[model samples]
Target: MAHTIREKNKLLARVKRIKGQLDAVERALEAEAECEKVMHLLVSARAAMTGLTAEVVEDHVRTHLVDTELFPDALREDGVEELLAVIRTYMK
Candidate 1:
């Protein structure tokens, strides 16, 4: 989205870090690492992904659904509800 252009670098950096975390998990698996260590890596990677999802969702809400100047009140409400429904499904 055009709104994301301003935050592209920041988003890419987060993605890169998440990639590294996943790589670490993969390496740990290949090395037959301890269960506890592997679990920690997996958890870290999952948290990073969750954080990235939250950032993108928040940006979308602010840029698209929350701007009264660009979107009417009823449309914004519907858009927000739809987004919330998606987030609920995602969190599950």
Candidate 2:
């Protein structure tokens, strides 16, 4: 799916921050930080990645599957089906 420059930038920023958090996790491991602290960081990083993935998937569905301007149009059914299939596969 194509993204406008602003949206792309926002996603990139989110990914970059996640990357930084990952790096911090590595550092924490190397420094032998408390296990709970490292685990918490790891969980937060995973949540960030999940959020990013959801955002991208939603954008893709919006652009390639659903036509936002033509909601209620007959052709929209096919798009909905396609998007649902993709999402089901993704869940697996």
How much does candidate 2 score in TM-score?
Answer: 0.67
Cα lDDT tens digits for candidate 2, 18-86: 999999999999999999989999999998887777667766665656555675453465766787677
lDDT of candidates 1 onward, in order: 0.79, 0.76
- By lDDT, the best candidate is 1
lDDT of 2: 0.76
User: Tens digits of per-residue lDDT for model 1 on 1-92?
Assistant: 54478889988999999999989989999999998999999898898888788767766776665555665454556667787778857753
On TM-score, the candidate that comes out on top is 1
Query: How many residue pairs clash per model?
Result: 0, 0
| TM-score of model 1 vs. true structure | 0.69
* Every model: Cα RMSD to truth: 4.1, 4.9
Q: How accurate is candidate 1 locally (lDDT)?
A: 0.79
Candidate 1 regions off by >4 Å? 1-3, 66-92
How far in Å is the alpha carbon of 33 misplaced in model 1? 0.4
